[model samples]
Target: MAKAYRSVIEASMAQNDSTIDSTIDSTVDSTIDSTIDSTVDSTIDSRHDSTIDYAIDTTIDSTIDPIIDSTIDSTVNSTIDSTVDSTIDPTVDSRVDSIIDSTIDSTIESTTERRYS
Candidate 1:
C-alpha cells in the first residue's frame, strides 16, 4: 500500500510540473510575439508616413513652385507694361506735340515779321 501511494503522488507531481511548464512557455511565446509585432508595425507605419510626406512636399516643390513663380512674374511684368503704356506714352506724346507746335508757330511769326519789314 505505501509503495502504491508513493507512485501515484509522483505521477501527479510530474503531470503538474508539465502543465506549469507548458503554460509558462505558451504565455512567454505569446508575449514575445505580440511585442515584436507591435514594434514592427509601428516602425513600418512611421516610416511610410514620413516617406509619403516627403513625396508630397517634393512634388509640390518641383511641380507647383515653378508654375506659381512664372505666373507671378508674368502678372507683374504685364501690369508694369500696361501701366507704362497707359500712363507715360500719352504724356510724352502730348509734350512732344506741344513743343513742335510752339517751334512751328515761332518760325512762322518770324518769317512774317521779316516779310512785312
Candidate 2:
C-alpha cells in the first residue's frame, strides 16, 4: 500500500511539472515574438516618415526657390526702369534745354554787339 501511494504521488508531480514547463514555454515564445514585431514595425514607420518629409522638403526647395528669385529680380528691374523714366529723364531733359537756350542767347548778343560797335 505504501509503495503504490508513493508511486502515484511521484507520477502526479511529474505530470504537473511538465504542464508548468509547457505553459511557461508557450507564454515566453508569444511574448518575445510580439515584442520583436512591435519594435521592428515602429522603427520602419519612423524611417519611412523621415524619408517622406525629406523628399517633400527637397522638392519644394528645388521647385520654388528659382521661381521666387526670378519674380523678385523682375519686380526690382521694373521698378528701377519706371523710376528712371518718370523722374530722372525729365529732369535731365529740362536742364539740357535750359543750357542750350542760354548758350544761344549769349552767342546772338555777342555777335550783335560786335557788329554794331
Candidate 3:
C-alpha cells in the first residue's frame, strides 16, 4: 500500500511539475504576446486618432481573439491533464484521499502557525 501510495504520489508530482512548467511557459508566452499586443494597440490607437472609425477596433479584436482563445485552450488542457492524472486515480478512494489531504494540510498549517507563534 505504501509503495502504491508512493507511486501515485510520484505520478501526481510528475503531473504537477508538468503543469507548473506549462504554466510558466504559458505565462512567458502571454507576457511576450501582451507586450507585442500593447505595442500594436498603441500603434492602432495612434492610427485611429487620424481616422476615428470605431469599427476598426472591433476588427482588431476579432483578429486577436482566436490566438488568445487557442492559448487559453492549451493552458486549460495542461491543467485538465494534470487534474486527471492526480485526482482521477481509480484504485484510490477519493474520499479517503481528500481526508488525507486535508489532514496533511491542517497538520502543516498548524506546525507553521506554532513555529511563527
Which lDDT values do the candidates have, in the order given? Answer: 0.96, 0.94, 0.88
Q: Regarding TM-score, does 2 or 3 come out ahead?
A: 2
Question: Best candidate, TM-score-wise?
Answer: 1
Ranking by lDDT: 1, 2, 3
Tens digits of lDDT, candidate 2, 20-113: 9999999999999898789987898999999999999898899888888899999999999999999999999999999999999999999999
Question: Residues 1-117, candidate 1, lDDT per residue (tens digit)?
Answer: 999999999999999999999999999999998987899878999999999999999999999999999999999999999998999988999999999999999999999999999
TM-score of each: 0.58, 0.54, 0.31
Residue 7 CA displacement from its true place in model 1, Å = 8.7
Model 2: colliding residue pairs: none
TM-score, predicted candidate 3 vs. hidden true structure = 0.31
What lDDT does model 1 reach?
A: 0.96
| Candidate with best lDDT | 1
**Of models 1 and 2, which has the larger lDDT?**
1
